[model samples]
Target: MGERVQTVIVGAGVIGLAIARALAQAGREVIVLERHGLIGSEVSSRNSEVIHAGIYYATDWLKTRLCVAGRKKLYPYLESHGVAHRKIGKLIVACDQEQLAKLSGIMEGARVNGVDDLRLVSAEEVHEMEPHLACTGAILSPSTGIVDAHGLMLALRGDAEAAGAMIAFNAPLEGGRILDDGIALDVGGETPMSLVADEVVIAAGLGAQDAAAAIEGYPAEAVPPIHRIKGNYFALSGKSPFERLIYPVPVHGGLGIHATLDLSGRVKFGPDVDWDAEPAYDVDPARGEVFYEAVRSYWPGLPDGALAPDYAGVRPKLTARGEPARDFVIEGPETHGVAGLVGLFGIESPGLTSSLAVADHVAALLGYGKAQ
Candidate 1:
């Protein structure tokens, strides 16, 4: 007979750890299952670790709501937990006159989403703020910042462990079946075991769909398709030209190849979206050629050979290329017709920022609080 547990959180990424912490703090006996031996080896630590200001998403969308709510909780949590972070702000620049109207439109949308701190700046004002930036106009998002992603994940893991939550590393959720009493999960890896959990949360980033399908009886039609949108990064060799993060107006699939800094003040630009990418991380040097063109649109002072292929990350997008963007799908029992089961699909971008709030919502779905 397999062991019985109160809850099993699939994937020990930021979202899973956050959920484990919340549920454990709520006094639920929780277990977090991770395929990797260490925590947060995938989506949690990849890409720009920016604390978004809830500006880019739709006004009434879950992305905006959770991001806004999560950002509010995250700053205080980071401070009290002693995590390294910076409120260094961000700029959404319009590099040419043609992009100015769109810049203002983004500002208006942001204001509608309760991003009250956004300020419109003229070319002269932007130059004063970022000397290396050449823009016709810009939106100064003072609340946009960056955090130590690894530190944040560790903090979440520590909190979950402190609350009596156990994490099983190298424990992948292979396959399972829905039972009347509980969901029986087959744990795969070395020393494989079986676990019948009263509740399960599929927060497995790119593998979320497969995890959900493994549980026999989860609606096949409900599982959203996963698109591996790979975004490549290029690290700068010389001193960082800008002080704060600099963003171009968003492209179709991503926030563009914006300049983001780590806590050490090192600049890395990237994540130019690759629609037809496999689950790989190799950064081709030839890709740097495209980065040079994209980056020089705003910072024309970029010197040749300054960029070196750094790393790449793939986001589990719900939409295919050319389709309109979809909202974050935190599917609970009420929607999926599976009791005590919640599957999170397409939880990209603002996902790290919204981790805590998403945890709260997951708890609510499991009968803890109101889902808001």
Candidate 2:
């Protein structure tokens, strides 16, 4: 028999780390099994790192609730813990009259979703805020910001470890069996081992579906189809043109390719959605062509050959191609008939913004603590 733990969280990404912290803080014995040698090596590090303001989601969606709540919870924690971050705000621009009219609906939807701080600004205001921007109108989201994601993860790991949560890096979940009172997991690493966990949470970002399938006795029908979309980011060679983040109105399958700044005020444009079969992190040079056209829509002064491939992140979408995006699917015993197992699916954008709330929800689903 292998070691027995009160809880075993698969994946040590932000959400997994947050969940470990929450559960460990609740006096539960937690062990985080990470396939990679370091935490945040996958989806956690490969993201826009922007803190969303819960504006784009529907009124009743989990993304809206968790993102808003998580953003609210995150700012204070980041400040209190001395995490580097900036609430520099964001601008959603509309270049044409048709797109400009869509801004109202976006604003209305944001309001319905409890994000009342978003304000519609005229073309003059947009230009005043960002002279290089050429939009007819814009929606300013004051609550949106950027954060040092790795620093935040370090804090979460510290908290979890302080609370007795043990993180075993390089221990990938190979497969598992659902035991009578708990689940057994086969973990692969430098030294292979087996573990029996009273509770299990599959928060594997891109590997979520595979993690679910690895668990024996899990309902096959409950596993949703996954679609992978590669979002690539491009770095600017010169000084950033704008102070605040600039985003065009959303497009099919994603928020349009937008420009965002890091904590150091360096600008990068990205994440143009490219459907793919497998995960690819390479930033193709040819893809830079599309970014120039996209960025020029908002900033016409963009210089040719100034854009270069920077980094890329893959979004594991739960919705199929051409299908409307779906909500965060957090399945617990109620859905799978498996006691003490929860799987997170379709946690893409707003996931970083919603990490804490997602953790609280997952912990509450396991009957550990209240989601606040």
Candidate 3:
């Protein structure tokens, strides 16, 4: 609103905020623009907040690399910043002989992704760890854990601000024009004004497609379309009995309705995947019917009516239903021919865990190393 910034980030989600912190730490003049009143109001806030263990993605892709690198970087950052989190571990349980047969391949995949410490535990050992869980076998991933996403975002915001980054909330970006010097942004408000930036990064998540269309000469069609995949969760009424996070074998669309504990030890289950044409955040209580059937598969004694709709999060999926899942898409000058512009799409699931690594990658893409 005042003057052009050296760098402008067009979203204040976790990904954007982390990049801001990284760039600002390098002493760049940074300004973060957020359409919402607060940071992380979209998909960043509405997620499982599970720090992934580098599984489920093909080894060569960005998701696999960033997730693996991010998992290694996240715990140290959390501890250094005093963010609340737990290394409470995760179990990929095999409920039947068919799923049991897939455990070896899953382990092999984890190994390929550099996810060490994955142990194939017997059903007897699983029962010893989680008394009520039913399973033929399970893979123990000690690195997988839960994080306080809000707290982590706060720390990143504080660090960025301390490094002289200015964050402007409620400053929705209307559109932009590519000028000879740089991109000029048309911002909305009571007194709308145009501001120029030497560089711009669009980490707008689900809104990325619209953001891409705003930039001249940028291929909107090449940017993969976003599909809203809604995942619904249910909170357990009483105190949690399980010590570790309990999960079932990975299903086609999502990780099965797994039991996850917050840092406070309150238990919740779910995130069963449902594809929708329009993105909606409504959490339907009726979905409890499907939840009971799915959850009871792992926790047989789940009391009737103990589970209630707690929350819902939508995933910005690059691939549609019945298609193979795709990797993270980070578009830069080489791909789009727009120097100093980077766009990120299909960043879901492991996004929180991969925040720092993703930021580093974006920084590299922006010619930060070359600038040095």
Candidate 4:
């Protein structure tokens, strides 16, 4: 017989932390199981850290709804909690007249997704804003910004802890069994243990599918196939040439390789979608050759030998290669026939920006519909 707990959230990444905070603040006894000693050690830490403007995803997607709503909630929380962030804004540039036509559609998509502040800027306006940029035109998203990812996680953890959520570090979800009333999870760590949870949320990002497949009686068919789509990045050696984030027209599989700035004003490029790459994080220097060419298409002044491989991240995509991207999967009992179990899948780029709202959605799935 395992000890019974009120709620258990697997994974302590940004989404899990945010969900834990919400449940705890709602007065639910929450326990978070983390496989790593440090929070956000995997997919959460290694990324561009840009706050998406809910522009790219479809108008009806959970990505768009939650990202727009989460961005609204996130800014105030960051300011109130003293987290480091900046609304430095972003530009979706068009390299040619054909690409310029795409910008209008992008702006319309953004408006449909509740991002109404985007402005279609002329090439002259683009150069005025970023002198080094040589785009034919661009869509300026003022609500887009950057945040300290680790800092935001710390704040979420703090709030959850203050509200009575306990996170067990190095506690991996080995497996679990579905019970009559709830679910019992087998967790492995320095010391293995089992806990029966009244509710379970699989917010394991990259490991979401594995986590879902492990639990006995969890619908195997309901667990969506995960594609390991990798993106590689490169950093600029010198001072940043742009004040704001720069982007190109949306490409297949991703929003194309673009320029992103961290909160410290350091510039980096890429996350060019590597469809056939292995599930590894090594950034091949040879890949920089592709980044140089892609960046020069919009920023022609990019000096030679300036790009150096920085890092890479893999997205847990639901769709296969060449298929259109899918929406966030917030599967609950209604959809899966498994009471008190919710699985979050395909949470990739806009995830950080959508954490808070996704948390609320997870809570709603568990019958706590109101956001606390």
Candidate 5:
């Protein structure tokens, strides 16, 4: 028999670490298991580390709710913890006259989602905001921002550890069994071990479906299909052109290849969508042409060969191609009938922003609170 803990969280990503901190602070004996040698090496460290403003999702959606709530908590948490971040804001631009009308709809949706800080700007105001930009109109998301993701994760890890939470690296959950007393996990790492815990949180990003299926009793029908939507990035070679994040109207699968700046003031664009058969991070140089065209629609000043393939992050989407994007699916005992077990699926964009709030939701679902 392996050691028994009050809670075992699989995946030491930002969300997992956040949950670990929350549970440990709640006085629960918690352990975070990660497949990597370090925390946040996968989905947590990838993609645009933007602090979303809760503008793109539906009003009733979990993304909107958690993101709005999480963003509120994150800023203060970041400041108090000395995590590097910036509320630099963002602009969703309309390249043509036809697309200008879409800005109003987007603004309305954002307001409905409780992001009332968003403002629709005319072409003159758009130019005034971003001098080098080309757009008929734009929506300024005043609360949009970026963060030092690594620092945030490190702080979360430090807080959790301070609260008596243990993080076990290289610990990949191979399989598990649901039992009466608790859940059992077969953790594979430097040394394989069998561990049991009273509660389990499956916060695995792309591997969420596989992780859920490993548990023998989880409902198969309830496990939605997972797809890898890979978004590629390209870095700018010259001086940074924009101060704020610049975005085009969202496409069917993603928010379009938008301009995002790191804390260092370096400009990078992308995460243009591509469905991958498997997990791969190679960025083809030829794809730069496509980026050039897409970005040139709003940023015609883009110089030839100015964009270099930077990095790529894969989003674990719940639905297949051509289908509408699905909301974040977090199932607990009440829904999946798995007592003391919770599985988080399709945690993509705004996930970083909504991480803390999501942890609160998970804690509530697992009956971990002051009352408990």
Candidate 6:
């Protein structure tokens, strides 16, 4: 709004908004610029709002660290704010002997990642926990749950606004250039205007790389290539019979098709992995055929036509096809020699759970201490 502020955060997704709140809470003036009319319109609003238990990632990686730490921070925040959520827990089911072999490895991974309370359950115990689920073995994650993502975002916005952070909607960042004075932003629109700031944090999610390209002197190589990975969901029409979230053994690149329950107890299954170069968000009802087969593997009583196209989300993956998946890339001035600027890429799964920790990490990059 004014000529300048202490910081400018690009993108209004959960990550961006959370970062803005953290910075403002640290007593720095902040402004969040969003291209959409409302916040969380992109990856934030689309994904399964599952709070990931620290599993499937290497112990030392940022994904594992942030997810574990953020979960500790988020649960209390949600409860204190009156946001709708359920600690419904989750089960990593083993459909057969081959899958059963992998359960031990998963438990070891979870333990090393500082996740306690992950216990291996036998077929009998699984029946006791979920009578309708068909499985030979399972790993119970009591900390995993779901949140009303939109509601969580609203609370975050309220906190940020209350702390004096300003947000401008429909304000797409056109470009920017680093100067001796400060960083200058060219916000594109009918009333295109330029503003300066001491520091800029780019939390643009899928658009992070593109936004980085717009800034002169920012290295192209430093901006990781953005790959869009599509995940599809199917909503169950009938009342939910299951009480907790159900998942499959950890699969490379994703947690396989599983059942998830919302705060209202509505059941849904989905987010089967599909990679697309151009990336389409539309959910194809025909995919329900595939979902039916997957869901029936664990729940035999699923009725026909009950599973319908629910929604879809695209992951802002940093790796390309045939390449190994990389951890979160939060490039800052030290990496690219662009002072007062930071870029976030590949903030995908577990991102929702890792939102607060990610915000703290970004703030530290800008030389701000953790908010007390």
Clashes of each: 0, 0, 0, 0, 0, 0
**Which digits, one per residue and each the tens of the lDDT, describe model 5 over residues 1-372?**
678888999888999999999999989999888888998877888889999989989888887899999999999999999999999999999999888988888988988988899888899988887899999989988889999999999999999999999988888899988888888889897899998889999898988899989988778877889888888899999899899999999998899999999999999998888874356787888889889999999999999989998988888888777899889998888898888999999998889999999999999898875211
Backbone clash pairs for candidate 5 read none
- Tell me the RMSD of model 6 versus the true structure: 1.8
- The lDDT, on a scale of 0 to 1, for candidate 5 is 0.89
For each candidate in the order shown, give its overall lDDT on alpha carbons.
Answer: 0.92, 0.90, 0.87, 0.91, 0.89, 0.87
What are the runs in model 5 whose C-alpha is more than 4 Å off? 276-278, 369-372
Local accuracy of candidate 4 as per-residue lDDT tens digits, 1-372: 688999999999999999999999989999999999989988889888988888988987777899999999999999999999999999889999999888888888888888899998898988888999998888899999899999999999999999999999999999998999999999999988889999999999999999988899999989889999889999999999999999889898888899999987888897898988997999989888899899999989999988888989988888888897898888989999989999999988889999999999889988988532
Residue 31 displacement in candidate 1 (angstroms) = 0.5
Q: Residue 334: error of model 4 in Å?
A: 1.2
Clashes of 5: 0
Q: In model 5, which range of ten residues has the least summed lDDT?
A: 363-372
Q: TM-score, each model?
A: 0.99, 0.98, 0.96, 0.98, 0.97, 0.96
User: Which residue runs of candidate 3 sit more than 4 Å off their true CA positions?
Assistant: 370-372
- What is the Cα-based lDDT of residue 41 in candidate 5? 79
lDDT: which candidate is best?
Answer: 1
User: Once model 2 is optimally superposed onto the true structure by TM-score, how far is the C-alpha of residue 140 displaced, in angstroms?
Assistant: 0.6
For residues 171-201, what per-residue lDDT tens digits would candidate 6 score against the true structure?
8898888777678888975566788988898
lDDT of 5 at 189: 72
Per-residue lDDT of candidate 2, residues 246-319 (tens digit):
99999988998999999988888988888753578898899888899999988999998999899999888887
Instruction: Return the top candidate by TM-score.
Output: 1
